[model samples]
Target: MPQRTNNGFGLVRRGLAPALALAFTLALALMFMAESAQAASLSSSRADRRAARNEAKTQAEEVPLTPETFSHKLVLDGQAGSVLSFTLPEAVHKGLELTTFQDLCVFDADGTPVPFQLRAPQGTNQRLEVEKELPYFMWQPEKPGAGTPGTMDIEINAKGGIVRIKGQTDDLAKPGPVSYLLDMQAFFDAASSPVSRGGLAFADDDLRERAIKVLLAGDEPFMVSVTMKTSADLDSWTSIGRPQMLVRTRQGDVTLERDTLVLPGTAKRYLLLQFADSDVPIFSFAARAVFDKTTHEVRETIVPGTLSENKRQIGYTLPGRFPVTAIGFDLAQAEMMAVRLSGADDPEKPYAQRASGFIYRLERDGVTVTGEPFPVTQSNRYWRLSAAGDIPFAAAPGMRVYWQPRELLFLARGKGPWTLAFGRQTAVQASALPMLGQSDVQTAREIASPPTDTGATTPAVAKKEESREWVLWAVLILAVVFLSGVTVWLVRSMKK
Candidate 1:
């Protein structure tokens, strides 16, 4: 057939025979694809047999099994619970024998003698000594169990005996695994510093009673303020007129117990205090407080900073005297509660410093706070929250966030709700704003019995009671900062 073609059509038609053949080839590829898929359904029978044979050979090999008269070695490589077990006949009596009753052999990581003495079989002595040069452990049963060879349990009893096996099982004579253990510290004393005595001064009467306790914790020092007070509850605070001890100072190596805490309280729920300037390295601070027989629930966190070289003063003034108030927190929970007060303080003479404070609700849900999601408290980071009326740990529908008229952080947790005060010489003249009657939940426990004179009736003492009020006001005022700045401050302050 003569195919009609334009000049271009003829050029295209020149390969027509090849084009028809190409279409046939494409059809052939599709048919072969199905066969390729079928081939994928199966593997090489010879390769499969070889893999099965290799696995079976591995299973047949014994894991270094030996008769009761065997001495094997193992390396721990610092991994916890990497144990070395050996099966031996009663004939291997050189090492301490272990039974379901007690441990067989014990050795410290530094190759020291433990208090325990291994008791072996009735006729033989169980004593295994470390073979010098070789890191292999030598052990024999102190006493064989009732009726089994390897079935008997080997128990250890001196609290917990950790065996630091070094090197590899094959190379027990040399070191291999270079692993360290966190458990190396059974009970490490990780304290920072402790202070006992130093120089402290008081202006007024130079009179104060101070109980200082220095704790070695975190990489910094923390302090809590306590007033030698008298109260029925451990909440309301009142300053005493007579200075019991004036103040406490530290000048030597600090111990754990005698680390004098400026504040006084056996309660574990401690108030952590630190410096305002985060970089201030505190050599030590003096805690000054007036002690009275009838004072109660009176204390403020005392933090010492720049005392050795610079001016030393409390972090807060009668709010407004200075522009900022410094607060602290448990150095551990720095994220939870940290605050400072600024913008108020009375400076004039006869300076009747009235205590000032902000009243906010301690709202929470399970473990989370009401509005502030992040555990952060910087300037203006607070969200307005409704102050639910007086309620226990239980949340209720009636809870509404309303601004309290009171200025101080004294409500239900301390003396009386309205009886609380802040930064004042006395509770009577703290804030100008009067507080509403505190719900019973805020009142602290009253002192059971005040110091009584002969035939004299003791006055009613007040304190903080058990309530769900966990306000961050105090923490905000005293940021328990660590002396990470000591590296710098020590060099500058110390007149070496």
Candidate 2:
């Protein structure tokens, strides 16, 4: 009986092994099912976002050029934390080439873009990544006049936490306004001179009233103090500029001062500073002569305080160095680029960020914007607009822009702002010309011809005027005689 019981126990132990193994496999399968369900939920959320973006694209195509969306139709489509959508219209769409890679932009509430992934069209061409060769999408419109529409049938998938879209489809044939804002930043090189801010409290009290010349070395708007230190001991000086580097910013706008005249007539300088405080980055600059009045003459006097000693000063400290930037804009296109502002030979700094402000090219189909001299040198020159509803290239993010219907030319740098100004005179606004340091401005500031107390016009000028008058009289007389003869002939013919 004992032997039989032992055999039964062994049999039961062997059978239990297979049962336990089966139970363990079943538990693993259940866990996998739960994980898959969670994954599907996430995917559904993304699909919903994508669908929303597609809907926005549809609306953009349907809408026309209204005051509301004149700026751009594609502001993000969802809530504060949701995915964004934008519509790329024709004006900005000129540069998109579906042939190669994709354009990566930031999706934001306003027109600003946040970091995002631009997916390619599904079931069609595979999306190519430029990450290795170019990292980011550097906008390069085909050479002016060379811009041609790229192949249609393109879609963009904007993704950060969520995925959204904007692109061209056959139903939406007409290219709308390019609907993406760049994170643009322009600044002055704080390194060259002491990089101090001037928008609010300028270092020197006299700076506010003192006229100072500015030259941009970068796209950033910054300040520097120039002291006409005295040389009583042959090594000291005092501040000559009142409110030195006294920069004025209205809200996010920057108001600048300039003593270095580009010329006494028709032109003044304006420094562009459109950044908020506590915002710092790699600096760059551009210089301008902000005029006090529409006459293009913004001037201030910084009375040099008493120089403790007669022999205390070495020399008059020239006001702040004039920084110049070769900024360009296009009114028709409503786009602007700070192109160049560096210490290097050409001074062309082509980098950008969010703080950079925009300019408007007040234009009339190649006609000079602002009526300032648009020399042949700047034949290819253009400007951007910033007034609200005027167009994208015109308005500044901080201010409400009231546009002047006439085309215009505007200039700005990193954080350099644009304003909504009404014409103060016949040609109320003046275009800021591309200046080449003081050397170039010296010519513009100089009276075209010196004004003499003699009150007598230069002999050469007088002669030319007299000759012009005589020629005008002669032409008038000829025209009258010709008209009389023709009239007489016509009357005779009618009588016959």
Candidate 3:
């Protein structure tokens, strides 16, 4: 009976082997199912992302001027003082080129339009790893001042028994208004010597009033003309000058100050006394000058140029397709010349006349006193000397183009691959292609993940999902193996 019972137990244990084996196999199958499902889901998600990115690229509207199919060059004489112009072909805007590239060409000997390759300005194209958006303001059309920012005039009334002198002060900056009281009774007592009383100090001997200033009260308009002298050491004095003030107004408007006597020398501190033909009581008066507040913000950017010392002419070219509203040079001396911009749309009628006037700088006693600011306006390219003359170019004459850059629009079409072609013509062509596919994408800053409603998948999210799948597969594999080993051991023990 005992042997029979043992055989029954053995039989039962033997049956358990197949059952355990089946269980192990089923566990493996389930793991495989999990892996398959994860893979399918990942693949579907990736496909959706790709489709969305492609669609966004197709609809991308804000594209910069592609250098590959747009830019061109012309052959014209960049004479020192002769007008040159190049008009763009109207055919460029006929197609979707404006949204892609604009075609520009120059005429050959037979007036046949010959297209030239595009060359981008050096260091113009760049891609950063982080997203960058800069905010800038556009300039509204500003009406310039009628004359200058600030004006000063001296008026003398000798016939009215009282010398009534008046002044208008628009310049309220430092070195502005300096007032002094001149007692006529004390002038006679000094016996033609230096007087220093009542905020007024000056030498009466050989003393020429370098400048006379008048103060304007509320609604009291006055204009005065007075000879002024300026001295650095109070021993040497020079005459005031009638030169243009090369400076902007307080509102940041650039214009020339005309018919004004500029102070001599660079002395911040000086003394002033009025010069009168008669014993007139020039008792109390004030003076002032204006400085631009915009100088600190809208500073000048010097365009690249090459100067020839032999020819005394500066060869300069404004880089890129960006238009400049104002084009001028930093002048070292007073000069007179003309400027021109060249175009090629109409070969017979090709140049726009810009300036045919004097560029003046004020100097007193061979020292820089003051000057007029450069005129600012016009959107032009290929500007050169419009008149015919050989003015010696100053050493290191900086050619600067002042322009308020237009604000740009960058469409956030998710992040993947983007291609940008710039630099020399050949390089641009080699890297250029129709805006399609993931073949050549620029390394721009990773765009932020779109809103959840857009059903967008960011790179970060995809990587995280893959990691979770790997972890789940590993955990399931280890659990199955562990359970299978335990089942096998328990069955063997039952058989024993």
Return the top candidate by lDDT: 3
Candidate 2 residue-wise lDDT, 286-339, digit = tens: 222221211111122121211213322111111221111222222344443331
Error of 2 at 466 (Å): 90
Per-candidate TM-scores read: 0.13, 0.19, 0.25
By lDDT: ranked, best first: 3, 2, 1
lDDT of 3 by residue, 1-496 (tens): 4454557577657778776877778787777877786888688768766766565444332333332222322223222121112222221212111211332322323333222322221112111111111111111112321211111222323421112223434331222122222222222233234444333333433243322233223332223334444433333545545422212123345332222233343322322332222122222342222111111112245665555555444455444433344555666666444333232222245555555544445666888643333454554444443323555545534566665432111121322122111111111112122333222222123122210121222222223466757777887888787877877777766666
Two-way lDDT contest, 1 vs 2, winner? 2
Give the better candidate number (2 or 3) by TM-score.
3
**Best candidate, TM-score-wise?**
3
Candidate 2, 340: how far from true, in Å? 32
For residue 228, model 2's alpha carbon misses the true position, in angstroms, by 14
| Residue 406, model 2: Cα distance from true site in angstroms | 21
Candidates, ranked, TM-score = 3, 2, 1
In order, what is each prediction's RMSD in angstroms?
44.8, 45.1, 27.7
Candidate 3 Cα lDDT to native: 0.36
Q: How many residue pairs clash in each candidate?
A: 88, 93, 33
